[model samples]
Target: MDSDMSMHASYAFKHTCWGILLLFLAGGVADCSVVVTVSGPHVAKVGSNVTLNVFITGATRPTIVWAMGDIPVVTWTLGSSSPPDILDPGGVLSIERDGSLSFHNVLLNYSATYTIRVVELGVGSNTSTFTLRVFERPSGDPMCSVTGVNGNQDLQYRCQWAGGTPEAQLSFPVLNATSSGSGDFNLTRKPSQDLNGKEVTCVASHPFLQRNCSVTARGPADFQPLVSSMVDADKKLVITIACASTSLPVATVTWSKGNQILTSGGRYQISSNTTLLFILDFHLNSTELGTYTCNAVNILGNQTNDVSVLGPTVSDLGLFPNQEGTMVTLTWETPRTSVITGFEVQMMGPSLLPSPGGRQRRKRATNEFGTIQEKPSSARSTNISGLDPKATYRFRVIPTAGATRGQPSKELRAGPGGGLSGPAIAGIAAGIPCGILLILIIIALIILCVVWRRKRRQTRYPVSRAVEKVVATQPNLNTPHTLLTGGLKTSAGPPDYSVHLASERSSTLPSVVSPPPVRMATTV
Candidate 1:
């Protein structure tokens, strides 16, 4: 036991002797009076680089040592015979010959008290320490929200900034309020009368980011609608009205007549949110010409408009028949027309034609035929078909304009088969002259044929008959050649004798020697 205790005491004595010798050596080297100081920024952002420089004066050759919170991290010496002069344990530190230490890609763990020591070859070491602060930049700008409180008399606004190392600051100008709450800030203010329609603003600020947001205050207003009325072509009364309002909150529009509420369906058409159209179709009467009202309501107040109705007017009226006489088309014209619903046609006809049946049946048929017909206003004309061909009928037209009917037109009559139509009469007129000319031509041809046949017989058989006749007249006058040579008859005298002989032969022959043939007849 004594021997072990003496061994431990000798080991402690040797360590103390070595420590004192090192201290004396350090004092002697520091007696050269070399001074070292460090200068640089104390704050740095994460992901940024920083340099802490150890500045030494009055030293020709110096060594640098870097430590973090009393833990040695690296050391550097100049012109050392050793293989490695720089001792960086974690490879996060580097040093320059000027005793400047640099940290790359600094992190939160790097935020600490850092000490830099500088030693001259024959002088003692000098040390300096500085606190390093590392912070992260804000990821985004501040967000702001505004809401109306206390019935819009006051407004509350908040600004928020998140995802940053340090808290953000918020401010409200309109509200004159500011408060911070864990990266969020809020403010509320009761506005004065002068602040009406003013803008509310909130601004936030941080070391790395700054942002602002704003909103405006507006109030509601009142408006009235404009209304008008007219009669449509379909004889329906149309009411048109529109209203508009400029308000923060939208206004509602409605249509009404007297105490009756009108909506968008059937006869009432809501053309737009602000416009309406009312059509009077079924209960069409003069009463439809009345005043209409439009109401536009908002938070501010309500307004109304009244428009009186403009009734329809009547114009030119006429009637005519269709091309086919079986159907009669009644036509009439409307001038300055507006919203004419339709036309109505009324007809009265003579009693029905006598039938093979009894008188009671005919009377019933006549009653049916006299019934009136009506057509829509769009159909400018009314066609009445299936009428008795020989029967006569009277037609009258009435124009309806917006629940009002115009004066009836004058009556017109028509008969389909009572007499020849215009076309038939015109054809007869044209054919009469041609028929007379044709009959005269036929008589003339017949006369020409008879005369020609007589001339043909005279030329073919009369010479022999003349000789035979002379022989019969004078027993020895046998031949026409003897008569010709004897100069008994000249050409004129012989033609006269031939005619006289022809007249004796047939009583139809004419005298005056027939004046020699004007045109000779050819035998075929």
Candidate 2:
């Protein structure tokens, strides 16, 4: 009985040992199933530092391997004393002891798929993928441009921003529109009259930064008007004026004189486009001469330009000076009318008196008439003498009817050295070159004349024989014989050169041609 009990205890101890060994093996197998968890898909901006961390489970003494697109980047055994092995030549990549990958100043070329493999010693290995993306921020604010389309009925706004990894997203807040990744954004809308002078804005968005730009909507700018007058075939004065303006939808132009608006009628003719105004058969005595206003109106704003029309005052005013430059003759013409009683000649020059400071300081010259002289209505010209030749002068003529003065003529300037006017100087300057050219022509004519005389002497006998033969073959006339003399063919006989001497003894013949009559207009 004692032997049986000892054997049974031994058997039970063996069974307990086997069961404990199986349980230990099973736990070891479970621990060997290594798993790697990582926060993947990393994102970073250029010139920034980033890290891709990994959380590893069921690993002991983990050996970490990091690769980027099939290329090994770094590897290290966790808890090792030595530094992590970095396979990158630039040394910009590193691995931490916790199996995390670090990038110092990431570059665009570093953006790719990265794989991290965590292997537990005497266990299985697992991998986690991390996608790295490098982005670039926009350099500046987006630019905006506006243009008219569809016959200027609609305005198109465009916004653009260039140079980024993924193009920036653009939006127009006014239109509630966004870009479709086409690199630029566009929005078009019909502009209403009330929408004039409105502001439009565009915005650009990116992961790294955001920007915007704006423009203004306007209308009716830069108004211009041109006025001109001329005389018609019927001797009637005609006035014409044209106006233009720049605007988005075009503008309407209107013409007015004083408080009365003008339209196409008996005398007034407006163009179909309403940009031109013409007054036909304009009479000086009529109430047509005044300030004419052209108003251009549009949805945005209005602009006005004024043009003045006046009756005939003075025309064709001329200034001539003597050779010594001390005296100047002023001549002018006017429509012979009873409205103008006489004319006033006004002159302006430097003050002859010295300043109180005892120094002749140059004073600003003014248009105020210093010397005024009146001439009768019949006098067309007058002589101004006893003038300093070295003083510069400016002259203008004002027409007066009893007490009221009409418009003044344009100012004429005469430089120093007597009354040498601008036209006189120009004439003198032109005459020099003309004189030289005339002399050269005269010399050429003389040389030609000499050569002609020699040639005539050589051919004189032959020419005489030929003429006699022709005269003998021609029919005889009842009148006196005629001869060609001085290269002239005359119906009557050759003119007697000696008759001029006899005429010199008698009174000089009178000029049959009379001066042309001047046409004058009636003035009010």
Candidate 3:
């Protein structure tokens, strides 16, 4: 046992002596300084190639090891015949002899803290670390939207770009504004006239991509005006008109007549915002009955609408055909007041054309007014005659007080068959030609029968064939008012003084006809 232990101790002392000798030799080389530097904390986009270069000084035959975080990736030794030993099984990482690291078709997972270690067998060793950040390039163009703010008095514009790493820088070039970090860029302000129809742009900038989006600013739109009339105290008529509009910037409202702009004055009241107008002492014969126009103007454009007031006329005039169809009874209702002296009935129908068969064909002629008939104010119904039973006719009633004629009533139709059913009239018309042909055939047959009978009877029976021809006939069927008023104020934007005549009565007053209120948008 003593001999075995002595042999073991001698072998260990030899190994220890060799270790100390190597250490003394290493210490001599350790005096040389080693320095290593990697290019940077680098940046690269996915699917691209990048290199993290390394610089070394005072190092010889160095062995380099590269790691990502705590995980080993690749190792290379200077002047080694063997290739680098890559820890990565995917083959995405590579190293050069100079201790540099390179990435091929980089991926997002490749982003990490990368360390390069340089070592020389007899010299000092050094390590350098850098961060590699992998980012995705911005995809597609930026998106934008607009919204109303401050009760629609201002507009807010927002722009954004998605699917980019580390956020993208966004800016409104026109406004010279920018947003921080990854948030969207927003701008809000009242729109100006000059901005109307102009394009607003947002640009997004990133390390790997650039994109932009835009929108057009708009002006005034959707303007409408309403007009109404009523009876006020002192038995005077009052008229009210209002206008409204929508615009990026609020629009201005103005009232006008033909070639004239109206302002607040005697008998005329306008709202401060220029949206409402009121007329006092309105009468049927007054000059305040012409067309009144309202205009809404904005920086972008303008829109206008018109309303007219007129005199009273008749209503609901109806026409009824008599049993024989030759006459039509006309009935209508009038306003409660005595504004109308009488009603004039106007008739229009086709003229009769002579036919060889003594039957008449009605020929329609343009502007063919047949006759005008008059009825007293107390009479609500009257009979119109001298109409062709087979022809159609149209009639209208005009309300008249002496020489002044108010607006006319709606037209009514009286028809092709005098009191005949539609099917009966159709059948009669379709059978006329067939009846004529049948008559000729029957006459010929009768003549032949007569001659044959005469031949058989000879002197005993002398037959006289006389055919009486009967033809079946078918029949055919068929303002300005002035108002009296007091003196009114006038301006350069003068309200029209021409009185307009209309047919309907107002809700509160009888015998008052005003222009029907209209809603429309007229672009200027």
> Higher-lDDT candidate among 2 and 3?
2
Q: TM-scores, in order shown?
A: 0.36, 0.38, 0.36
lDDT of each residue in 1-524, candidate 1, tens digit only: 99988876675465445434443445435533677778788888888889987778766665555667755555556445442233343456777667687888887677889876666655566667888887776667766655555654455566777777666666775566444454777666554444445666667666655667665433334444444445567645665555555532244667777899888888768766555555645343456557667676543345666655434333554555556556666666654213455566776665434444646433322322233666664566666675566677766676665456767666666875445646678999999999999999999999999999998876442234555555577645454454235454456433666776886788764455433323333555
List the lowest-lDDT window of 10 residues for candidate 1.
Answer: 362-371
Checking candidate 2 for backbone clashes, the offending pairs are: 389-418
* Model 3 spans > 4 angstroms off: 1-32, 149-151, 176-183, 220-524
Q: Is candidate 1 or candidate 2 better by lDDT?
A: 2
Best by lDDT: 2
Query: Candidate 3 on 285-387: residue-level lDDT in tens?
Result: 6666677888777545677777664454786798898877778899998644324556788877765335446665656744555546887756788887756
By descending TM-score, how would the candidates be arranged?
2, 3, 1
lDDT ranking from best to worst? 2, 3, 1
Cα error of candidate 3 at position 427, Å: 43
Model 2 vs truth, CA RMSD? 37.2
lDDT of 2 by residue, 377-496 (tens): 667888876555677777788876445567888777665644566778899998999999999999999999999999887632223455556668876787656563446546577677
| lDDT score for candidate 2 against the true structure | 0.71
